[model samples]
Target: MSEPTPQTPGTARDDRLAGKVAIVTGGGQGVGRGISLGLAESGAAVLLVGRTLHKLESVAEEIRAAGGTAECLAVDIITDGAPEAIIAAAVERLGGVDILVNNANMAMPLPLSDYPDDAFRTAFEGGPRVTFSLMKLARPELAKRGGGTIINLVTSAAVRWDAANYGVYSAVKEAIRALTRAAAYEWAAEGTRALNVAPHAHSPGLDWWMENNPEEAAAFVAGIPAGRVGDPLVDVGRPVAWLCSAEASYLSGATIPLDGGQSRWG
Candidate 1:
């Protein structure tokens, strides 16, 4: 993919997210990277969190070069203390957290009966558990800022259930979908909104699948009404950026499908 186009200094479209701080897990690459850039471009100071220091730093540098504020932290979200540490870093580096994007996840495709127990456990630990922990940790920080938004990156497989060998992965994502809705409803009074974004984008995971199962990948792409898989930044990042902005203040407890009409769920 091409490098993200840099925005000119002092030419930001609008500072809807000005003065806000955001934490984007898995912000080193693919959809996470896109969201981080989109948020930064919209005038929010961003903290990019992921396991790879180099990848995170690269993305942070890109944001900085684009005249956006950003910082990078390398840490595994599944670790016991990671959530708290991420929130702390955001607070110390960017002032405070006004948006949280729980986009870090493991994509494992294994048949249900053949799936290893360890891998299944790892899936849940990495997906729902870590997301829950992060949301819980960031709640007070968001509240401190009067209000904020949380966007959980999910998959179309979780809702459609058409793909084989995705049982475990889909289940874990479904759990996150449930948690997102509950948080949206319960946290409404606290001014914190929660939602989900289901995107179909070109990423390393999709590349892997395409290389291993060319026929399946082709069929999947054929199903998209948009005639092509989405660009991570142009397609997925824009909607997520809007979700984190004040314009979407009234949107909560919903899942916005970014799959270009591939999935019927609204």
Candidate 2:
């Protein structure tokens, strides 16, 4: 595996993840992008996977510009072949995987009564199923390194269920939360740790909501005790990076709230 590039003058390098290899799905944008950059900054070779080739390329370029190593793969995670392909690519290019961030999610805001059956299936496919597939596929690679960390991006809505049109989304995310806990126990002997991170950040999806419904957006921000939405990288990504490091090796099966105290469940 390639080592992380040396940091430039006046730049500090946190080598907690030195020589580690990570795969971040949906890494082309929003929370995934933040986590991808954060892991790279911490000294991990990252494979950024997303459906949009251009977006993945852009994020990869940003990582390269920062003197960090990153490669982009554009693939739809909902496909049957995607998880295996992703793991194969990471192992081929970066050597082995030490971290897996399942951040790719598909959500459609609609009440249960009105939600289409196909949309509901797609939501589950994009959410928990994709996460499960990736984790299983990456298991051997992680075990090869003695052990590794898996972070699945969940949401506060999974617990709160307060949002009017998010029933399907919440259900799917909650399923992933359960899977994360189960994986933590089942994969422990193999040296893999599984955890969930529920974040409330200013993501691109939220940005779109803010643009379409200003009143709801204002109310959402006002509800947070932090008095503002969290930055994707500053608030969410750093914590995720820490979770993947040796300092947090003892942690597993926990759903950490990265939502500025907005989530009722920790």
Candidate 3:
């Protein structure tokens, strides 16, 4: 584990997660990268898992440069035996898993009527199926450590009324949400916590969309009450760090929206 230090003026990083081990899926880029950085900054050893070797290595390099311990494992989470392999890697490498971040999700946005079977299968296999598998495999390891935290990356579109062509995507995310809640309840006695996060943060995908369609992007930003897109590291990651720490020991199962008030969920 890395020792905490001052990250910026007036902000002191603490050793709240000192000696802990966290495994993050899709941890090389975007929100996943943000969370990985966050966990590392908070003094946890992070395992960065994703499909691209270079991307995972890049993030791992960043963590190492910042005096944090991190390892990279390149593998598609949707593949067979991936969940088992990930758990084994985490235990064999980082000692054990104290936190699991299921951040990799595959989905094709299409209307229910227009959605194809193969697309749906891809979404199903990549999202909730893999998430469930990882959670199932990580439970015993988590329990062995007296309990752990699981964070599932979800989407606000899952609860939106005008989801439109997001039926397939929303369904997959919603299923993950359900799994989070169920795990929160089922694992409570064991001290394991599970929660979902719906973050609307800037990413490479959003950057491309904004660059290609400024008007639409501007309109979308305008619709957000915060008046701007959230920073993946600050808005999404730091808060998630809190959630994974003792600070949020009492919080679990609920979906925390990091959209800067864009969502109106009760």
Model 3 lDDT-worst window of ten: 1-10
Please provide, for model 1 over 47-102, each residue's C-alpha lDDT reduced to its tens digit, 9 standing for 90 to 100: 99999999999989888887889998999888889888999999998899999999
Off by over 4 Å in 3: 1-12
In model 2, pairs of residues that clash are none
Please give the lDDT score at residue 236 for candidate 3: 82
Alpha-carbon lDDT of model 2? 0.86
TM per model? 0.92, 0.93, 0.94
Q: In model 2, what is the error at residue 233, expressed in angstroms?
A: 0.8
Q: Which 10-residue window in model 1 sums to the lowest lDDT?
A: 1-10
Using lDDT as the measure, the top candidate is 3
lDDT of each: 0.86, 0.86, 0.88
Each candidate structure's count of clashing pairs = 0, 0, 0
Question: Per-residue CA lDDT of candidate 2, range 40-159, in tens?
Answer: 878899999999999999988887887889988999988879999999999999999999999998877788899988888899999888888888888989999999999998888866
TM-score, candidate 1, is 0.92
